[model samples]
Target: MRNPLNLKAPAAALAASLALLAACQSTETKQETTATTVPAETSKTDSAAGPKFLSQPLVKDIYTADPSAHVFDGKIYIYPSHDIETGMPENDKGDHFAMNDYHILSMDSVGGPVTDHGVALAVKDIPWAGRQLWAPDAAFKNGTYYLYFPVKDKQDVFRIGVATSKTPAGPFKAEATPIAGSFSIDPAVFTDTDGKSYMYFGGLWGGQLQRWQKGTYDANAPEKEPSGDVPALSARVGQLSADMKHFDGPVQDVKILDEAGKPLLASDTKRRFFEGSWMHKYNGKYYFSYSTGDTHLLVYAVGDKPTGPFTYKGVIMEPVQGWTTHHSIIEVKGKWYIFYHDTQLSGKTWLRNIKVTELKRKADGSIETIVP
Candidate 1:
């Protein structure tokens, strides 16, 4: 039977290419100078103090979620899944299944309000964008920006696509139609220290890893299937060409960890051992963070490499007030922080708000999440 998805290049080559492209773009642009500030430690005397962590609302009125932040030209540019609620109701397919527009929000500081830069990229602009445009991940390389995103056709089937722009906040143009093949969502692009690039996706179809080869869009090429069951969630890493359009090797599965830095097993009944894979390297070790269970508890693991033999680090943050969380981790100014979405302000699931908080690594190499 033929797989319904189209994929280009083996997993490794594709990752390498993305890294190169991001690096090249970084070199061409001036680095943003506005330093992201970490909040001072809360005083024990302040009994009424709210959660120690707080995130300034970036975009308002419009329901914006799944934010990815990148610094460009002295500003923090956020690319988020955009929806239209104020204008002519552009109903692509009924109200609930409407498509999205990728918009860029800029701020001078991490805690600053995100200013609207308008629509950075949109579905109608891409050739194969049938309707749904979800999860936009951006990387800069060689004076150009690569915005990778997941799109669905009129049928609501998902595929990945790449777009290029000269600036982070840009009029990005699609490079190709949904990258050949694949039915995946939550596309993440990463570039490693050795200049290798990788792309990871696959939550619903279990976890899959593919390498990108030059001049091809075959995600299965040089395929390396994951050793374990499709993690309730999983992430893959690989090397990419400097150009950011090709791959150099195979994609590998990353491991989940417990608080003591031990591996955690996914419950066979899908009770939430793993989901939502996010990665970052600090202090010579790579940290892989993910969500668990329907409650969306946060957990992490540490590894020597992007791909693991990782030691589980345990729960970083648990669902608050019965609210679930989806998050990403980033390091700024040598401090680690967690960026996650929650139902604090808007109880509606679709209206969940994004939050950021300082994360402290214990002497044991585990993280303590501060609630905001």
Candidate 2:
């Protein structure tokens, strides 16, 4: 049976689905002014004897994936997709990932207990959303917290949305509609050193990026990869308006090129951009990383500017035990960490759990590939 994108089931049916997801589910209570302790397990890795899992699932009660972690006010805040057990058969279109809401997670330090701030945002709360609340990101501006996410509108086209709250953990109120020109998934908002912010977004395959080849959405376009011989699709980057809600200008292509200055072709699945766009600055250079969806590897490229003609660097992570790999990198207290997910908790790709491990870089600033 095809899963309904809007999640507009009968009350009883919806309750049952929620019940199936209740194990690790957090409450839907009002937002709190102070952080509250939720049941979370600290890392089980022993430094003396290296373990196979760099770190255990930060969340076990409720499944979480595609972690977008950031350090704010001396604590780490994680914005992740809240996975659920939807029995719809898995497909390339990600039908089984029928998540309708999001839960924000936080911790004071690495290896410390995590806290799940329940139901920061939900489908029913957003006026324009249809379903499949995929991976999301968070940013702290002047004094408010902004949450950027991708959801299919009532028309079933993916578009980016924004919600806001005074606290990092939110019972957020969403804007009536999505960002005007935004179309596609995995919205990563990167604030540069000069205090300007840019949003990088796009995804291929079921992400419906191929439909936007002419820079506008074409619903009739086929949902398939481009010809292997052609240059692969590029992700997009646009400067955020001063309000942090809209785009200041039209988005430009973020091209990842080979060492020989050639654009990666669709046939080069191992290196071409797929879904999961992330940007972080290291040593004054912009590092753009993403998941090679079908290839299952997390790779990166580097450029001098935020909107880049980046040169492919190398793999950041080998394939994890999952069909898809999505991630984020952040520096905390002089050390860097990578937050990603796999199906270790449930052994099912759609129902995944997020994990974190320290990241190491060579003296020349190149990242050491993580063999998770």
Candidate 3:
């Protein structure tokens, strides 16, 4: 039996026939965060020997995946989803990826031990979300830290939600409803240098990118406006409200550009994004990084603005031992780092753990390939 969790197929597919017997089972709530009780074992530093964690899997207490990093309050905070083993029924005996909560890990300086700050958000708190908590991204607006995450709705389709807290390590309270018109997973928020905010969200098997249109998502109904390509394994982008709680304008399809600088429409599933959409702005350019699906390799492209017309660079990090590779890129105190997850620990693709490493770039503004 092929593993059903590898591609993060929409909850619609798994909720009915597969996940009920696997990770999405109702009994699995060991990781969910409650206002009075969060269930992760917190620790500071390396679990093995030396300070190996700074350059390796920093999250050792529990399984974590799809990391998103941010610099706030004089520290670097990483928001990652919690993965668990649900005794999946498959030939590979893979993980059900029963992730239902998130944790924020931080550090005061480079080479310092990463501190697991406990739970940031959880599926049980979201009024509209189901139990399938997945990849998440965080950002600060005004004075609040907003965590953008994805979960299956009552209908079993994936929907994005925004949760807020005053602190980075949060007991974040998800809004009473999801961001009006969002879908899919991995909601990446990019705040441009000009103070404008934008969000890029979606995933394979019907993820989408569109600004807040302020209405409930009707998967069976016609779109409020005709969209270019909102289905399949594609990424989308749009301006977001200052509060980071809503979409403000029309969202457009994210595209990789050719050498001649034109949008490559064929990028929907070829060489670009499979999932895990992350954006970093440096030297007046935008670096769009993603986990190339089916290949489990991390790749990136460059663009002039926050939303692309990005030009595909090359494969940044080669494939790892896992069947899926989801990640994020950030610079803390002038040092760049890539935060990703792998199955090297549990030796099961579904039971992923967080990994971090220094990201080096050449003089020409291109990144050197990483073997990790």
Candidate 4:
């Protein structure tokens, strides 16, 4: 974790100042600061409160969930879905997964201010996307950055699409159509050591419950994500084109296994993948991580290749403090960090904000469970 530096005051000095403010400043000034403070702008600063709290909640100005982090040109860049208020008055019927756009945030070093590079893509720019634009992931290939996002079609079926830009923080333009053969949502893309890129996605437990039950992602499927939906919630991964705009190979349904190489039983409650699939390669070992159902914890499996015949591992993180937790893991300057979301600002589960914590792995490459 990046330690806070350059502050002129100590912890005691900050406490004394707050105490002095209480004694001398008008009550109105404090109320105004608290109410007017935007989360994105405020969270960038570290305080005398110390290290454990240093590199957390990367932005606070707006609700940013499903953080997708990447490193390019020696800077860490984040592509997170923008969460905002929605319903009919807020939504047609108060729908909750009502995200509309993406914002790119980047930092030169740890414990530094993350500058919002502005809107990278928006629903208004997608010709066929429904109003709800959900979790998104991005990749840098050749000289262009490709954004992979999940959006509901006009018919309400979930589909994944790509957007391209020459710069990392971009005014990314969406492709004319989504990648063919993509059916579910939550698209996460990973680029390997050999320059081969793969996309991982699917979360039937939350959206498409009935259609998922019907055993496919077709029209006339379930209207919303099924409650505690289990059964066949297998995630899919496929190699991407060199341009990163389309899938270039056969997409494979990830059939999770035990360390023994046997398929996970439906009864194995502890090792099922519910949603939020993130793939990264560490030390030649492929780590496939994802959030568990109910959205409070994340777990993973490992394999030797990019398209994994992965074996189930234990939990990576638990107690993320929100109804749902979406995350991404990236190694920044030799330090591994896991980025996820929780409702610290709005105090409402629907409005999750982003947070980051340094992640530790055992000598054998398994991650130690993180209780965030």
Error of 4 at 338 (Å): 0.7
TM-scores for every candidate against the unseen true structure: 0.69, 0.90, 0.78, 0.81
* Model 4 lDDT tens row, 1-372: 001112234455346434543442243122221112123333433453632332456765556788888888999888888776553232212257677777788887656667877667888799888867788888887888888888888887778888899988888899888898786778999888878889998875334423544446656554444335344356889998877877897787787887777776544545677678999888889999886654356899998888888888889987555467678999888899988886544444556678787899899988999876
Better of 1 and 2 by lDDT: 2
Off by over 4 Å in 3: 1-55, 90-95, 206-233, 260-270
Clashes of each: 66, 2, 1, 12
Q: Can you rank all candidates by TM-score, best first?
A: 2, 4, 3, 1
Worst 10 residues of 4 by lDDT: 28-37
For residues 167-230, what per-residue lDDT tens digits would candidate 1 score against the true structure? 7877678865666544445666666777666665544322222322233334444323223544
Candidate 1 at residue 72, lDDT?
Answer: 68
Worst 10 residues of 2 by lDDT: 1-10
C-alpha local distance difference test of each model: 0.55, 0.85, 0.69, 0.71
Q: Write the per-residue lDDT of candidate 2 for residues 1-372, one digit (tens) a residue.
A: 111222133454335435645644433233333345655555564233433466678876678999999998899999999887767887768878888888898999987878877778998889999999998999989799999999999999999999999989897889999999999999999999999999999998778888898878998888776866899997989999989999998998899999999999989989999989999999899999999888788999999999998999999999886687899999999999999997655556777789999999999999999988
lDDT, residue 196, candidate 3: 94
Give RMSD (Å) of candidate 2 vs. truth: 6.0
Poorest 10 consecutive residues by lDDT, candidate 1 = 1-10
